[model samples]
Target: MNEQSISQNKIENWREDRLPNLSGKCFVITGGNSGIGFEAAQMLGRRGADLILACRSTQKAASARMMLEATSTGTINLVTLDLADRSSICRASDGVRAITQRIDGLINNAGIMQTPKCQTADGFELQFGTNHLGHFLWTSMLLDRVEAAGGRVVQVSSIAHRLGRIHFGDLMGEKKYSSTKAYAQSKLANLMFAFELDRRLAKAQSPAIAIACHPGYSNTNLQSSGPTGLLNMIYKPLNALIAQPSALGAVPTVLAAAGLEAQRGAYYGPTGFFDMRGPVSLSHIAPHALDLERSARLWAESEKLLGISFLSQD
Candidate 1:
């Protein structure tokens, strides 16, 4: 970086150089089978943190486990977590509760992007259900454990959230739906949830922290796995030129998960222009994500919908 850049951040544009000993730290990362999630799992594993990959496919989890186990300095385990289905989420939570006593970190990284309008098992919009609600529920279910361990929760959002507005009236997209709009809303929800969780943790005088991160533009299968269209065809060719590799994309995630000086309620992302790609630092949060009242409403609505009250003011 140049002199001006250093003056702006003053943190030496640092990345994950060395990590503290995490020999017994346990981190649960969703979507750890591939992409940035897998990269993060590798980073944490190498630091000797036992890993629980809450992924969808058992077959892919097996393959991912073998890959991690080869170079992993810690143990790796897997449990089925289909974020689109409520029953599946609860079952996965039961499995998670059975194994570890406390959780060092919970990375809510798994998500689905733009796709044709679809509903989850409970009739919620696919993007909202999988990206936001499911994670909201899963993280809440594990909050007590995380609190007991004095752990942190890392929420992975996206820059696309800048365009998002929560369509509270049509959350399920039953009235109308656009894939990109739905995705943007879900990502925005991720941010609101992260920040709101931080607020609650503070209110309760809890030791746990809630932080968020964005990977910038990365060439991950997040696009390939979605519906095919003109954008997909064009994006596939441009991905190599425009997007960073998943390894670099995962740096912000690792920093948020285990950074030494990471602050509570902070949102980290690439400091590059438009936040496409660069060194990880504090990224700009959108106006919608700043509305404390809206976040509280969203929290209340989420609790009502999911039928769970994770944080109750004492």
Candidate 2:
């Protein structure tokens, strides 16, 4: 197929025939209630994977469970998770471990976009805390389980990451803050973490693989949490024109989660039009995003700050 046609096909069409067999596999997806996340969860569930829908609210998680059960032929479970709260992340990790001894895949899809600057319950910047740090700590706690199952970790990133530059000195956004910058930094961190994790896994000879993907501009609720009023009015029109459907935007993530050709630390996204729209393909990796030094620093800082250590475990 031609590149343009392939991109269009992947976006508009459902290719369930290409999905790998997942009858006995188990997966945990954060933010599985809405948009791309909801679609990804539904797709995975339909393909026969045992699914856990992790959400910040029990009600939303339950609702997501109902939706998945109604639409899928596989088992579905609901679990409470609030990424902005370290205690909540710890509790949820424990819950997951107690329920499942093995986790075949983990999709870190939960995130908040450009909201008004705020601090998490742990006093970290909200976007960075939830989008990057929460997932970091949660994944660390689950590393052994994932390794046991020979699983994969999918980090949902964004194209905006291209504009991001992590400021180690101002990780908390205390000196200066803008919603877009905060969101971009968090997304960039996702890519960094994914690559860094793959490096670690390689060194340790672990079976787990780490990958990253971005949803091409998709029509989702991501903007609803952003600056409201006039800014919302301006973005509404642009979103309508540029955003693909949530199902389409989720292709790269699903591919990363299940595609046989996916390699450790590979980054995937839409392959057309500045990566805002296109067929699923191996996308470009930013030089800074792949910096091992920065990634190691971030990993160590995250471990110290969260008081969780993945490397220390056997």
**Model 2 worst lDDT window (10 residues):** 1-10
Candidate 2 global TM-score = 0.92
lDDT of 1 by residue, 1-314 (tens): 11223244433344767567689989999999999999999988888889999999999999999999987898898999999999999999888889888888999999999988888999888999899999999998888889989999999999999999988898878888888899999999999999889889988999898989899999899988875687688788778788988988888888888878666787788888688898777887787787888888888888988888878542
Q: What local lDDT does model 2 show for residue 153?
A: 91
Candidate 1, residue 312: lDDT = 50
Best by TM-score: 1
**lDDT of all the models against the reference?**
0.87, 0.83
List ranges where model 1 is wrong by over 4 Å.
1-12
By summed lDDT, the worst window of 10 consecutive residues in model 1 runs over 1-10
**lDDT per residue, candidate 2, 1-314, as tens digits?**
12222333333322445688788888888998888889998888878888888888898778778878886776787778999998898898988888788888899999988888899999999999999999998898888888889999999999988888888999989999988899899999988888888878888889988888889798888877666677677678988888888988888888878766665677778878888887777776667887768888888878877877766423
TM-score of each: 0.95, 0.92
Model 1 vs. true fold: TM: 0.95
